[model samples]
Target: MATGLLALLDDIAGIAKVAAASLDDAAGQAARAGGKAVGVVIDDTAVTPRYVTGFSPSREVPIVWKIALGSLRNKLHFLLPGALLLSLFAPWAITPLLMLGGAYLCFEGAEKVAEAIRPHHTEVQASAAPARDPQALEDEKVRSAVKTDFILSAEIMALTLATVAESPFATQVFVLAVVGIGITLFVYGIVALIVKADDAGLALAREPRPASTLLGLRAAPAGAPTGGDRALGPVTQAFGRALVRGMPVLLRGLGILGTAAMIWVGGGIIVHGLESYGLGAIGHTIEHAAEAAGAWLPVLSGAASWLVTAALSGVLGLALGAALIPLAHYVVTPVLRSLKA
Candidate 1:
């Protein structure tokens, strides 16, 4: 009886160890897959904050929370299962679907670039439309944001799936769940923080006591103090003011970065897809150029090569996207309208 009990315990211990190793493998795969989808993640983060804009301070966080829940539902309930099914049955279709998504990304990125250069009449009119009821507007914004998030989430999931395509089925599922939940939390957490940063900055600027007091230092006498008795209130206020001032600039920068990432990543995907389809000539030429550029700067060769590849990819993306704009506006839109009619 004693010997049998010990064997049972040993088997349990071995099973536990296996489970632990499996968990670790899933984590590692999740991280690698998440890294591959970083471009979509960035664009998601950048695009989200705008949905909360124009809302009263009280409503901003709630709106973000609602949209976040919708985004989560999109990934876990819809995209995750669909991706698994595709991987299981239609594995060969993955490359073509990914290429289509890449093309969409390029179109979106290029459209944004075009808008920045010259806003269309309809776009201008839409922006100038009179405000509706606050609740209505808020609902509309959340729906719009969630709809946009679905497309971006699909891209993220597709990228992640592509990364783990060769992994075990269990590992693929685990990694997908981890990446989906992890990215949703991370992206929305940043969005929540960004949209409220100005409010935080304002509160900080309005601090009644010197920050030094919080640091366990005595508050200096009224008016600026000299020497070791320096007060930190003004410095704190300045930093707060700077934070408030910088938020707009930061948002603009994020938008620009997101747009560029969309184009570059989309272009890179198409180039790779073409190579996979045996049309490697374009990809090879770009790689050779990158390699030569890297050779010129051996110390920074990796970064140089990556930058060169990305630049050429962006050029290809912009060209393709530009060519597709007219087709989309003139052909696709009219066909869709006619179908609906």
Candidate 2:
């Protein structure tokens, strides 16, 4: 009986070791995969803050939390499983699907540019509607945000899966789950912080006391020395005021940058896909240009090459996206609306 019990304990220890190792491997792979999807991640982060815009301060954090939950649901419950199934039975289809997603991103980015250049009357009318229940409006915004997140999350998951395609099936699943959960937490945490920053700044600016007082400053006996004893309060208040003033500009800049990133990433993906499928003319021409630039300025070679490639890709993405805009607005939207009806 003693020997049998010892054998059982030994087996348990072995299984624990294996489980630990698998988790470590999964974590390593998750980080690597997440790195590969950083471009999409930036776009995700950039795109999210806009959803909370014009919302009441009290509603912002809750809205972000709901959207974050939706994003996680999209990734874990939908995209991850779908990605796994695709990798398992139809690996060959992954590239084409990814290219399609890239095209969609390009379309979205270009549409935003066009919208900015020529604001839509329909959107203006929609915004002008008589006041509705705030909660209902909030829910609509959450749904819109989630729908956008689903597309971005799908791209992130597909990129991650492609990065880990050679791993065992179980490892692939584990790695994807880790990346999904980690990214959702990271992205939403940042969003929450960003959305609340103005409120935080307002509080800080309005409160005359130094931040140290909030952390249990010792009471000064007979007014020997207090928060007003130093310049910290005024300085902090000034900083807070600056933050309050700067946040809107910062958010706008982020929105613009995100849209540009979407176009750049989408363009790069399409170009790379073309190169992979034997239509390498564009890529080769870009490479040759980059090399020539490098030879002329050896010190800036790498940076110049990257800049050339990125510039061409952005142009390509913009053109492709512009071409698709009419088709999407006229054909695709009508078809989708008809289907829904």
Candidate 3:
């Protein structure tokens, strides 16, 4: 009995050690994968805040929550299995799929560039037109945001998986799981903080203590409510004021930057992918030119490389996106409209 019991204890100890090692490996792999996806993650963050636009203060958090839930579903239900299957059965397809996603990234980025250089004329719904219910509009935005999140999330997951392609299968699964959950939580949590900052400021401002209230008013002004006015304190009030005034501008900047990133990342991906497939002459030529240009200051070769790459990518993205506009306008939209009709 003593011998059997000792053997059992030994086996349990071994299992525990294995589990600990696995945990460490998972954490390391996850960190590495997440680092590789910094670009997609940034683009995701930049795109999400716009979804909360035009909603009442009370509704913003909930809408974000809904979209977050959808994002979770996208990762767990669809992306997780798809990634595993692709890794197993069709590893060869992975690069092409990534390139396809990269192309999409380029197209989107290019489209945004066009929109910026030439703002569209949105004909406002006629006053006589039936007004869209505020709730309905909010719901639509949430849905659209989730759909967008799905694409971005897929790209993120695929990129992460690609980064870890050489790892053990279990490690890949563990890394992806941690990255998906961690990113989702981090993103929504930050968004929640952003959306609620004004309200929190107001609550602090409206506190009953006179000095506290005065300080709050001064500190947070527009954000916090004020004394006797139901507005928060002066500090909070100012903060709230600043937040209200600044949020639109901030969102617009993010939009522009995100669009630029899409184009930048997209074009870069395509160029790199083409290089991978042995079609790198254009990229090589660009690099050579950049190198020669930087010869005047050999120390700045690295910065020159980055500038040349970015400029080449942006110019290509702009041109491709511009050319596609007429095609999209004449072909894609009509096909879609016809399909819907």
Candidate 4:
């Protein structure tokens, strides 16, 4: 009886250790995935707040909630299964597909840059831009954001899968689930905080604690509006003002950076793919030369790879995107026009 009980205890202890190891793995993967998508996460957060900008106060949070739910759905429902299938049967296709998505990201980013440099008749955005009706606009924004999220999520999952290429199928699934849920929570939670920050600032400005209009403060009520909230308190007020003012600029920057990353990352993928198919000599030559030059400091080899690959990739993507742009404009554009027509 004692022997059987001890065996049972040993099994339980082993299972506990396995569960702990799994959790640790999941946490590590989440951190790595988060680091990988920092650029997209910034872009996502920056792009999202604008969707709630023109809405009424009461509707802002609700719309944010809707978009957050859509983001969750994107990661969990659609992307999860699709990514698993790709991993299983079409793993080889992942990089090319990612490159395609990356190209689209570059286009979107470049378009935004063009918009900024060009004219703006009104603060109003494009014609197909979001609506004002809370419900309608919420639905539209969620749909658009989810579409965007799917691309980013695919990248995240693909990267994670690559990292865990040799793991068991069940481990891959569990890690993916953890990554999806963790990233969704992190991204959307930050988005929520960002969207509500202005309101929070306004409230803090109005309900000035102990330190009132003494050092030149503005007072009202808790959660009340203060037009002078821009320059309310001394230090905190200045910080808030700066943050609020910088939001638009940061968004534009994020857009630009995201596009650039897309091009660089996409170009790298295509270049790597080319090498995989046959043209490996080019990559081999570069890598070998880099390693030789930096042989004294082996640590810098990884940096060398990143620099060589990223630079080559960006150049390649730009040339490719530019080459395709005209054809896209003349042929694809007209076909799209006719289809919509």
Q: Local distance difference test, per candidate?
A: 0.90, 0.86, 0.76, 0.67
Question: 26-52 in candidate 2: lDDT tens per residue?
Answer: 788899889867767877887788898
Ranking by TM-score: 1, 2, 3, 4
Count of steric clashes across candidates, in order: 0, 0, 36, 0
lDDT of 3 by residue, 1-341 (tens): 99999999999999999999989988988988776566567677777877887788889899889988988999988998899989988887777877777667766777776666788887875787897999889889988988989999988888778778788888888888889988888878877776776666555445443344455543534554455445323544566567666655766776677676666666766676688799998778777877876775688877877777777876776676677668777998999999999
In model 1, which regions exceed 4 Å deviation?
A: 1-18, 121-131, 212-230
Residues 1-341 of candidate 1: C-alpha lDDT, one tens digit per residue: 99999999999999999999989988998999898787788899998998988889999999999999999999999999999999999989889989998999899989999999998665367677896898998999999999999999999999888888888889989999999999999999999999999997887688655567646676546675555444566777777788899999998998999999899999998999999999999899999999999999999999999999999999999888888899999999999999999
What's model 1's TM-score? 0.89
Highest lDDT against the true fold, candidate: 1
Top candidate on TM-score is 1
Model 4: per-residue Cα lDDT over 1-341, one tens digit each: 99999999999999999999987876676577566555566567666777777777787777778777877787778877887888899878776775565565455544544455684566755797754666776678768867777777777776666656566777778877887777777777877777777776555444433235433454444575355542444545555566667656766676677667766665655556567678877567656755664664577867776676666666667676666656777898999999998
* lDDT of residue 39 for candidate 2: 66
- Please give the lDDT score at residue 314 for candidate 4: 68
lDDT of 1 at 325: 93
